[model samples]
Target: MSPAFNLETCARPNILALEPYRCARDDYKDDGSNVLLDANENAYGPPLADAVSLTSAAADAGLDLLGLHRYPDPHQGDLKEQLCALRNTHAHTAQTLTPANLFVGVGSDEAVDALLRCFCVPGRDRILVCPPTYGMYGVSAQVNDVGLVKVPLTPAPEFGIDVPAVLAALDAAVAAPDYDVKVVYLCSPGNPTGAALRKDDIAAVLGHATFNGIVVVDEAYVDFVADQRTASLAEWVLEWPNLVVMQTLSKAFGMAGIRLGAAFCAAPVARLLNALKAPYNIASPTSTLARSVLGPAGLAAMQANRAKLVAQRERLIEALPQIPGVGRLRGGTDSNFLLYEMLNSSGEPDNAVALAVYTKLAEQRGVVVRFRGKEHGCLGCLRITVGTEDEVSRFLEALAKTLAEVRQ
Candidate 1:
């Protein structure tokens, strides 16, 4: 008595039109020999001493071999407990966070996807984003059939969010009554931008009288920031129930391969994300490695590595502008990368010159950096990840040579 469903028509139209997120490896297939400064991965691998210590401890605790046969804990209580303790170090108030405030996922990408699913209804709800930021926010919105309202950051203030403009956009959406703005994504220590949004500006958005939606701040590169208070807003979750702060172990912990991310939010939102995620979302092997890196010894080693990377970032800032065809550096120096313009013979942004340098660096010199000229406000730009001392030296050499060849 039942009619058969047509799979093609059943598929959401928005998803049908969506293009997949192009990861670094998708564009350039690394044979493991190239100097990769394209993606914002830490050139220095995880701390060996702490890794060894963790392996020994896991072995003694009988957890080293357990992952092969058993499913990972659905609750991921142990890892959550460790994160809770670590986060309390910068607690905004005397109040401490518990596992109820946390949601663990494969990565922040999953958290972003889950939040949209939990809040936005297909073709009915909308989300707000500031441009020249993370690509995942827009990509996830497209996949979910949600409308995106963009209020680009004011270029004058060095890529700072235009809080008043965002408020006005939300009001306009409400007056029209066309779509409900269910979520707002903010990336601090932003990708490509390499800037941190001021705390007061973020609070202004969270405290908006008209917008009752959740504000998710992606702090993936927060670990690279020298000041912990400026770098993180996780503690603010207590004061602002609508706030959610997302972080990852991929950057500072050098565990991109592990694919673990954490979100700190109010209990209700955390519960919803958990409900929407796959039952066994975090794999056993991934959880084991995550726990090891989050343990006491591992935390200390991570801090040591962070100190080194921060130094390298500063060194790059000092030396990069000296190169030929390099123009003004944009945004704040909070993250592990820099976004600077590549100029031409006449000293203006030249996309052609930038592209040629990018191609030559990768193809001829085996040094790959990202060409971001196409992004909003990023004309003739190349976003380079801060690498090891040797890598930086090599990058400078290759860049100088490439610039000369391209200009000629």
Candidate 2:
């Protein structure tokens, strides 16, 4: 006879002790939704004209329009092919990438989760992260029952990864008898920090002989980075088998609703992730829309939108410093957002003041931005996304009013 499963006893201990990730929407749910500058989603929606053109082309190409009833392609070959073409155009590499090198997921979050599941065994395995970075890496680790080793970024060097610290941490973990560090998560054009980790620094981590683990670089905002050279390190996957580059259509392509993310890695790792993920995770409509957006016309529209957003980002960088009580804008201006401190009467980062501004802006002024004071090294900081010109103006005006009112 087969043994009966006890739900409580069978549940993993680490997962049992996990605190779930608090999404932005969860905190600010239905307080009369206004300017959604939180969550770092692109304010601009997807390229409708391009989508229309592509859909028409797709119909003409005899694609099954009623395929919504069916499951999405398990491999998502068409989307992967388009992604490969896109990557090849931007950064040419001698080694060609096939659909075999790609793994498509519902979003980058899924990729993150899948990567952990594929590589790290529950409770015993560990992952390294540079904090004041993406929250999801830690959250995913917790959910998967994987130990997280944090080597915090040096606050001085614009939140760059501390290579030596990372090495030491990895070595220490390796020397320990129980835990095995299986994955290292690096967020390029980092979430709240907006800093791109140097390629050389990343290469050093990848080359670390002692820590034989997969290095997952989350380039969720790579397209927003002005410098193309520093923006993407996907091509490096060809050279480093242990490297995995994750990107999303949500940020740059303005397809958050569609929920498509790409993972570029060596074939074996890709296969493992594919094996671990739900067979029909990416829905048919989502795949269809994703493929349409990844088409040539859609790519052109995305580029145009990117150019506009970058211009808007530059404008914000120029204007934000002039606002009263706004202090140092920390981190590199590589992504669409800016991380700056809110100073109090003493010109120091005042958590209370920052919280007041954040609350007042959302509650009273109908403008929303992230309050990241609790993050490592991000004292009294607000991470604001680069919105439309009008939105930016509104935010600035709202900020000025909120600061004055709070001070009064």
Using Cα atoms with residue i matched to residue i, what is each candidate's TM-score against the true structure? Answer: 0.84, 0.83
Residues 91-122 of candidate 1: C-alpha lDDT, one tens digit per residue: 46557788989999989899999888877778
Candidate 2: where is the Cα deviation over 4 Å? Answer: 1-65, 89-92
Which pairs clash inside model 1? Answer: none
RMSD of each: 12.4, 12.4
lDDT (tens digit, per residue) of candidate 2 on 1-408: 002212233223444344434445556553545666765644554344456776677578545443333334566778788888767633525777888889999899899998887777787989899988899899999998899889889893289989999988878876999987878899998878999888888888888766657888999999887766536877667777788999999998999997899999877667666766676788877887888888887889999888888888888888878888888898778888899889998889888989999999999999999999888898989999988889988999999889888766
Q: How many backbone clashes does candidate 1 have?
A: 0
Task: Give the Cα lDDT of each candidate.
Answer: 0.80, 0.80
Query: How displaced is residue 159 in candidate 1, in Å?
Result: 1.0
Error of 1 at 176 (Å): 2.3
